[model samples]
Target: MKITVLIENTKGELEDLINEHGLSLYIEKGNKRILFDTGKTNNFIVNAQKLGINLENIDVVVLSHGHADHGGGLLSFLKINNRAKIYMKRKVFGDYYSGNILFKKSIGINKEVFEKYSSRIEYIDNFTEIMEDVFIITDIQRNHKVPEGNKYLFVKEGTKIVNDKFEHELIMVIKENKGICMFSGCSHNGAVNMIEAVNKLFPGTSIKALIGGFHLAKIPAIDIFSTSQDEIDLIINKIVNEKIEKVYTGHCTGEKAYNKLKQGLGNKIEYIRTGSEVQI
Candidate 1:
């Protein structure tokens, strides 16, 4: 399997591509080419063009969750590839907040965009299959230790608090003879929780690797409320318990948290900069 990062939060000094706080991973396994998320904006298109990625060749499009950073590039993606089937949660759109700022978000294909490619978009309310080897885990029901995720997150029906459990956040499992390669957007459902869910769904399967945002950057600050080193240790320990061999994390994963994870995971973690590629 080939996983190429089309957009990320950082880039190498020699790379001229502009940096953005978003995530977009392009996966190619066998005959399938899948686009995980669209990054924060049209910069994804610019970066893809720079990398010579033919977006039109993508066979499937999957939205990890309903945050703008992950789902924002859909309009541009749809413009290029109108035939790819889309897999997303049922209640995709929602209103969210990054601290004080409000963000209008959507998970699945945008309603307006979907109208144009309704036939190709496949909305997954529960679990669904894209191919014989690729399966999407859509049933997300996990709680977090901190009240950080989806606090201001909700759906809109003319004006209502649509409880969004982040069901739109699906885990993509690519079957390999060794195990499964897990691809996630933000894992708003908690990275460890998502892994546990995946393990339960597919018994005895081990995660070969994890790629995408873990959203650990939003871990509450100690100054405002109260946090302890032990809590951080606990979180890190849980991640280690998953037995994930490697991790490529960035996007909303703040520098402080990333550093902590780096310290904990050490050699097992590889920082994913924009335009980077990993083969497994």
Candidate 2:
């Protein structure tokens, strides 16, 4: 499998690539060409062009959650790619927000985009294999504590704005001959819980790689960690115990949190940014 960082929070070695406060990965597995996310803007489209990637030929597009940073490029993607099927959770159109009582901002996708491209969008509410070897899992078990940063995220229910339960978030698992590679947008459900959930679903299968943000950092700000040292340590312990071969993280994972994880996991963990590429 080959994964190319179409867009990410930080700039990488390539000076020409664009960076933003979002995440997007172009994945090529066998004959399948998949786009993990579209970042927060059309910058992903620009970066793809520079990277010699042809978005028009992409076979599938997966929006990992309802957050704007993850799905903001949907409009641009729909305008360019006419044939790829897009998959997301059923409730991903809910009003999602960030911040506390003092202030809040809309962090969800624009409903107009969904309405415009309704025919190409697939709303998934359960575990489904979109194709052979490609699976989407939404029933994430809450076996561990959710992200501390999640407290600031909210979803509208009736007339009340309540804490988001993250039911709209989903994990993508791609099965290969050696093992499986899991892709998460931002682990608001908790990385440890996600790992355990995948383990339970696919029994003795070894996880070769785990990619995407862990939600261990505060949003709307940088250089701030939302989780405590103890929580970070616990998460590191779980990754080590699970024997996950590699973890590629960035975006909301926070620089401090990523460094802390690096100290614990050593060369097992890597920070991915725009223009980065990985082969597994």
lDDT of each: 0.72, 0.92
Error of 1 at 277 (Å): 0.9
Off by over 4 Å in 2: none
Off by over 4 Å in 1: 94-110, 143-149, 152-154, 162-164, 219-231
Q: What is the lDDT of residue 7 in candidate 1?
A: 82
Going through the candidates in the order shown, the clash numbers are 1, 0
Model 2, span 1-280: residue lDDT tens:
9999988889999999999989999999988999999999999999999989999999999999999899999899999989999999988989999999888898999888888999999999888999889999989989889999899999999999999999999999999899999999999999999998789889999999999999988762474776888989988999899899999999899888999999999999999989999999
Q: Looking at model 2, which ten-residue stretch has the lowest summed lDDT?
A: 218-227
User: Quick one: RMSD of model 1?
Assistant: 3.6
Clashes by residue pair, model 2 = none
Q: After aligning candidate 2 to the native by TM-score, how far in Å is the CA of 253 from where it should be?
A: 0.4
lDDT string for model 1 (90-139, tens) is 55654533432354434333456556666766877766667878889976
